[model samples]
Structure formats: C-alpha cells, structure tokens
Target: MAFAVSILRLAISTAVFPIFLLHFLGLWDWICKKLFPHFMVQFSKSYNKEMAAKKQELFGNLHEFAGSSGKLALMEVGCGTGANFKFYPPGCRITCIDPNPNFEQFLIESIAESRHLQFERFVVASGEDMHQIADNSMDVVVCTLVLCSVQNQEKVIQEVHRVLRPGGAFYFLEHVAAEPSTWNFFWQQVLRPSWFLMFDGCDLTKESWKPLEKANFSKLKLQHLQAPLSWKIVRPHILGYAMK
Candidate 1:
C-alpha cells in the first residue's frame, strides 16, 4: 500500500511539473503584471496605516526629511500602489520603479491623494536592472516588501547602493526567514515553493536581511519582529534603514 502511494505521488509530480513551467513563463507573468497589482492596491489600504506607523517610528530622524530646499529626489523600488506616499515629506519629487506596468494607474491615484508628494517619473523595470536611474543621483531609496521576490536580492541591493548619493539612505521593510527551531519556520520552508509560484516569486523563507547586513552600506539600523498573527506562513519581518 505504501509503495502504491509513493508511485501515485511520483505520477502526480511528473504530471504537474510541465504545467507549472508553462504557467510560470506565461500565465504567471500575466497575473503578476495585471491581477496582482489590483489586489495589492486594495490589500495595502487595509494594513498600510499600521505598517506606515511602524515605518515612521523606525525612520525616526529621517521621517520629516525634505531634501535640498523641499525638492527631495526620492525613488521607490517596487512602489506597490504607492502605499508609502503619505509618509513622505512635503514638496518631494518621487521616482517610482515597479516591474508591473499595471501599477501606474494605482500609483497615479495614490499620488493624487498625497498632499505633499509629487510624481516625477514611473519606470517599469525590475530592481535588479535600473540603469535608467543614474548612479549617485537619488536622495533616498525606499523598498518595502520587495526584496523577497526580486530575482537576485544582492544585485538589487547593489543597484540601490549605486543609485543613492553619499549620505543617502535606503529604507526597507521585508518579511524574512523565521527562527530556525520554530514550527513557523518549518511551515515557512514547507510552503515556500507553492508560495513562490502563487505570489510572484515571493520566497517565504528567504533570509533577506543577511545580504543587507553584509553590504558595504555606511551604516545599518535594523530590527526584527513577527508580523500580525494572521500572516502565519510569512510572519518574521525586518525593518530599518541602510545609509550609503
């Protein structure tokens, strides 16, 4: 009976693998490019206020920064629905980078609601490759819940460093790998593959903060905490700033 069950599992795995590949290449991209942004826009509204308060506290000294006579050149990588716009200082000019073009409309709507922030440009490009943004040009770079899904996190960090001016800071909030000994960690690892496939490459168990700590940033201030109880599989989170 056990042998028969093993054979059945093997057959199921073989059957599912091909379809997964096809979907990952085509349908997955479509969903990520289209449906995901709409879902994220609404989802962000539900929890952004709480998250934004935490972000404000973490970014204590920098929260009210209005760069260079109120013309801050801020760039947000993966600025999903512009959830962080309200936290920005008044009269700041923002460059939004997101891989999903569908997010532009949402971003525009959010910008319209913002009192102090203004849109400069929207680039539909991955964090790993943002050559259009020149080196050492931005006053600040913001990334939240982004590093977990990028193709190469180290490369994305490098790009963030390259684009930031000396004394500029990179603000981040990301869900990370849970404590290794915990049951949550086990579930995180077990769910990672399916989670990645369903959620646009988000890896539930990625130790995203390790690369940030190892990077050549001038200073790193970070704190780790568990997210809300509802986010069971990806609850471990890190938030802070890395100065360039």
Candidate 2:
C-alpha cells in the first residue's frame, strides 16, 4: 500500500510540474490570453442577456454628455476582447485598456464588428494605474469581470473615479465572493490558488464589492445576483453604476 501511494504521488507530480514550469516562465499568460476570450463567449451571451435592461437604462441616453462631437467619450478598463461593445449606446467613442497586449488582436476584431462604436485607441495598461487617461476626461468608464484579477482593487477604483468627468458614471459587472457559510464559498477557498494560476490572477474569494462601496462615488447603485453561468464557483455577481 505504501509503495502504491508513493508511485501515485510521483505520477501526480510529474503531470503537474510541466504546467507549473509553464506558468513560472510566463507561457501560461500567453495561453490564457489566446484562449480566455473564446472560452467566455457563452458566459458573455447569458450575462449580456440578463443585464441588457440595466445596461440600456444606464447607457441608452448619453446625449446629456454629447458635447460638440455628439459622442460620449467612454473608457473600458481591462477591456478583454471588447465583449461589451454591442451593448453600448450609439455614438460612443471607446478607449480600450488592458494589461495583456495579446488581446489587442482579438479586441480589434471585436471592434471591427461593432460599427456603431468609434475606435479611440487601445492602451497597454493595468487598471491600478491608468495615467495614460487624463483626469476627469471620460464621460463614462466601464469595467466587466475585471476587478477580481487586478493587483489592487481599491487603487483601480480610485483610478476609475479619477478618470471620469464630474457626474460621469462608472459601470461595472463582476463576480464576487459567495456567502461565508455556503458550500460554494468553501470550494471558492479551496480552489482559489489553482484557479488564480489558470485564469490570469482571478481570485475566487475576493469580495470585490467592498472596495466599490467604500469608494467615493457621489451616488452608487449596486445589485447582487447569481449569474447564469455553468461554473457555480463564479456565479455570484454584482452589477451597478457609480456616479462620480
């Protein structure tokens, strides 16, 4: 029995070592960037449908900010593949930002299909520091499923607030921590380390809404719901608009 257990352990180590090495060497980042967008299509479809009405209520009439150009200046931090483009209101000039440059190709393709949105630029920057965007310049700032992976959630929220013009809205949709006593929460804790390794720094146990509630948003409207996703671990979600 002891000999059999030793062999099984060795086998497991042999299978996992190569993946650990790939992650240490940054190849895992490349793999995630290349494949995560495609993997998210079905989830995005269900989420987009569920949140369509809320998005319309938030973005439908932006003419209020349509200064001389008649277009709202919007920035999407961590804009992976521009998945939210189709849901945006008309006449929006969008600036996309992400830490992974590999997503630029996929983002460009998404933009090509979104004829209603005007292309501003894609910047290789992390949400924690968006100095490339001027303070008080954006009419709206949007983020979807991004905060959980950021290095510092509070800093990112502050940067989002800083970049938005006075009265501009910051729209966000994110998966957050499950209830403390739930079985899902227990699994979230158990699976977090491996999940983070495989999914580009996403933390399954992050209570992302904590920082949002603490942020200095002049007006905040947040709602929590279980997203229609096959993965139960990531089903708990929060979506809302915060006014600066």
Q: What is the C-alpha lDDT of each candidate?
A: 0.82, 0.83
Model 2 over residues 1-244: C-alpha lDDT tens digits? 4454456545654566766688889798788877777766555677678767766665565556554566889999999878789888777899999998877878888899999889999999999989999999998898988999998999999999999989888888889999987878867776666677667789988898999899999999898988766678988988888988
For model 2, give the 10-residue run with minimal summed lDDT.
Answer: 1-10
* Whole-model alpha-carbon lDDT for candidate 2: 0.83
Model 1: per-residue Cα lDDT over 1-244, one tens digit each: 4454456545654556754675757766675567788778777876675566686776565544445665778899999899888877777789999998888898888988996777899999999999999999988899988999998999999999999988889999898999987877766655565567667788888899899999999899889997663567766899988989
TM-score to native of every candidate shown: 0.87, 0.85
The local lDDT score (0 to 100) that residue 148 gets in candidate 1 is 92
Q: Whose TM-score is greatest here?
A: 1
Worst 10 residues of 1 by lDDT: 1-10
lDDT of 2 at 10: 55
